[model samples]
Target: MMKKITIVASMSIVLLTTACKTKDLKMKEDRKEFISNKKEVVYQVFTRLFGNTNTTNKPWGTIEENGVGKFNDFTDLALKEIKDLGVTYIWYTGVPHHALIRDYSAIGISNDDPEVVKGRAGSPYAVKDYYNVNPDLAVDPANRLAEFEALIARTHQAGLKLIIDIVPNHIARKYEGMNNPNGVRDFGADDDVTVESKRDNNFYYIPNTQFEIPDTDAPLNGEKNPLVDGSFKEFPAKWTGNGSRRAKPDRNDWYETVKVNYGIRPDGSKDFPELPAHFDKKSAQEHFDFWKDKDVPDSWKKFRDIALYWTDKGVDGFRYDMAEMVPYEFWSYMNAAIKVKNPSAFLLAEVYNPDEYRNYIRLGKMDYLYDKVETYDKLKDVIRGHSLPDGLSDIQHRMVDIEHHMLHFLDNHDEQRLASPEFAGTPEKGKPLMVVSTTISTSPTMIYFGQEVGESAAENAGFGTHSRTSIFDYVGVPAHQRWMNNGKFDGGQLSESEKSLREFYKRLLNFSLNSTALMGAFQELQSVNRDSSWGYDPGIYAFCRWSTTEKLIVVTNFSWLTTSTFELKIPSSIIRKWNLVDGTYELTDQLYQESKLTLNVTHGEGRIHVVIAPSESFIYKL
Candidate 1:
């Protein structure tokens, strides 16, 4: 009897060992699959302000007094520091040659009339030249393009892609492509200016009327230039960038820029060829083939060549400004060309209308769009204690089909700073908000230059007021300067709170980038926990992200004054999907790794008691 029992025990031991090896092999396969799916992290820096160390921050300051960051400022060390921050793409905002108030005539660049310029530095969207880099961004204005190319090489050397603005909807009032390639003509060079609208005209004209500068108190920088005399010479007034029809646009209008006519008549009818039926379902290569032999509008050919020019220069992608203002057909054509040239080119657009989101992605062939109207607005409401966290579930549900195409960001050049009183009154509130933004979906995440260091943007920088950083003025970003630390590119002068905030950003961003589960399936646990668990409140949010080999439970508390002690629950449906059974498991905080919690499962349902301090978040990995 003893010999028979030993044989049975030996057989059981072998079976258990086999099961262990099978489980290990499955885990390795799951990891390989997860690694194939990558989530991108973009770091946006205002090109003129990122490396500027001068803290003068004078309102309406000149580039000489306030100083400007050059292409050389993005040294190998600076690029390395940005890459170490877990950024995959570096968006060099305001890199293109735009209409600025500064004079660079020695390099054959024309001076822009200050009356038509936004501020001393001018708006980057008001692009003056498309074929050349901004002369103001070069140490040697004569070799500006070469300097920018060097920066591009350094960016690639640091193992990061580069993105620059491509403003397709409009151009500066004083448009001039001085460095246009041989045989390439300027935008309006071939236009018939006497007509109100033409299929091939680059701009719309209010025939027989001269352009008049809007009546304002003064030029944004206190009339520093002699040319700020309330006059800009245009033979026939063109339509304003915002589609104003009058000879004199309102002060609130986008007066600094003139609209580009994309074969759409003044009556809002398409004069260009429309896409064929069911073309949205076709591939980009198919679209490219369709337009290959077809005759397109002149403006179409111009912009396409411009985009191809930058693509040839090693620019990895573009952030198109006000893309929705242009026709969807143009994007289908333009994006198809870009994709054919560089199959991996990242195409991000600023499209706000939610109804047009799918059309832009499917037909326009765009990779991503700003989630401003839905996700951004809803998150801001939740952060301000004006709404509950449950609404995020509804948003996720609505966007499930295209969730991966929505790029999430808490701060950008266009938004109010998170640390400003106008936003959340403190940078600490960003902790929970950012935790949600980065990990809530499979979409890419973006971080503005000073967002990590809590730049309040309290300075009233001339044309732009307090709450948002000035894109139109030559000014120093104070918080970012401390991080620059006199070109060392380290946070040498950062305060304790600022340092902690940056570290929090670093931890969350890095984890979100490398975590395989974030790029996998996601399920919101908010509704389930609220219905079944105790200590649940509107201030708390919970979700589950899982892959074949990894599972994560994320929870955040937005309340600045109240601590949340809650029993977070993961429902049976998600448990079954995660292939989890009735058992006890250990969950550790992936962000801080400072705590370990026990998750007890029974009947396929899991529950864990969690204590989230005010404005804190946890990515508990199981």
Candidate 2:
């Protein structure tokens, strides 16, 4: 998990004269419908902190001290700004009821012991109640689900889809469905606790063994819990969420929640029905039809119902956390059911195994999976000087079969910040990496909210030390807070450089969302230039993306400290395909048009003279 992706930077800013003050103003003048091949841009906003105005980033801070962002804070204007960023989907993380240090017993919700929770506000993955919403996100705790529903409505009204998390692998240690519909039953409600494993039992419990609190350091003991006596008793200890069989898991383990038993017995034999050979690449509707009368484990049905409940409430998709850990057959059932309800739903997963990528997408029915282990990791090596830019071409070559389903990203809540000391140390270092990440494939692109503005997670927010933004603490993100400008939803408080970096992201993302060439054809020019006689530097990565109507010759510099001028050649074969005439032509960098690049053509080979800034990219269109 420690091995990860890092920073980016830009060449120059390209400001459109028609750029209006806000999204509403710009849309009225320049907005256009999405074309046939434009990529979907997913903007992941950590829901709890997106609109928080507080700057006091106290470690393990309480909601009152750090201050919590509300559901209503994602106003119509805020949603529009995100929409204008060309985002098709908004992954609203931390929307469900999780194990946090809060008391909601008065409203039929049971309390989670502080010793079992992860930060002052526990991880969003540990669901305390599947039927309710996180009360901390609501202006009125009693109306939390209503507030989230309203946020969903606002997101759609602003022309963006909403994606929430569906963590099926585990539930909170204190799992209780406080608001389950009349016919539904909470997990473990009908289990026979004496048994260690049963095909239909919701949990794998250690009979007669009481669960012990992990011997973690005190700051995270979480505000004087009456249950922190280290004997937070469970008569029969359930298996820890990370699949640790230990009744007392260590602090380093996923000790916050318990894993749900999906009928995978201790011997790893499946009790549920397996997918047929023909179901491998079948349509979701086909999968749905296949499972219409089949019987599944109770846990599988519980999760499918949860997904459908949200879809009925207008939520368009889901981002499954640690999806590979869950059984494939369950996903075959759940995803197919979800698709039956909403065909275009965006279903993404955090799957790291390259070997299992195709299985998860084709058999598991996942729409997208993380490219973190492939191109993303290779890009990091290029930046850290561990490898050359050509390594990226190898990743592309191997992923050719499933390239479209691979999602590209430079930043996410789980990764280090673009400006973190552990990464590239400045927001200015993110532009070039971002350019390649966005344009290299036809897959969807995602950017964490603070990523565009270069949010350096210098604050030691609770569970996470630094580098990555804290998903488990109530801390305000510094750089993002500046962009928020006390709920103004404008970058009025950002530094000059921060503002410019944001402008670069805005232009780049907007272009990616509207460019047909990006979703058209991808031809690797890195190898061509690397083996060229004119001497191309290893820090430079060039490629060609084109459609019948649009063609882009992209060149990106991975060197953070060296500026270079080089001849980026557009190959003879490519030129012939474009039917470009044999002549000298002046081409403009579509991203930063201040300088004009000269392209010379002779004997079908075309060469362009370009001066690339350190850690910046040039997107030239003719």
Name the 10 consecutive residues with the lowest summed lDDT in model 1: 16-25
Which regions of candidate 2 fall more than 4 Å away from where they truly are?
A: 1-36, 219-223, 533-535
Q: Write the per-residue lDDT of candidate 2 for residues 441-490, one digit (tens) a residue.
A: 88899999988888988889877678999988999998988988887788
Least accurate 10 contiguous residues by lDDT in model 2? 20-29
Q: Which TM-score value belongs to model 1?
A: 0.94
How large an RMSD does model 2 have? 7.4
- Candidate 1 overall Cα lDDT vs. reference? 0.85
Among these predictions, the greatest lDDT belongs to 1
lDDT of 1 by residue, 373-428 (tens): 98888878776655666778778877877878899998999999988887777999
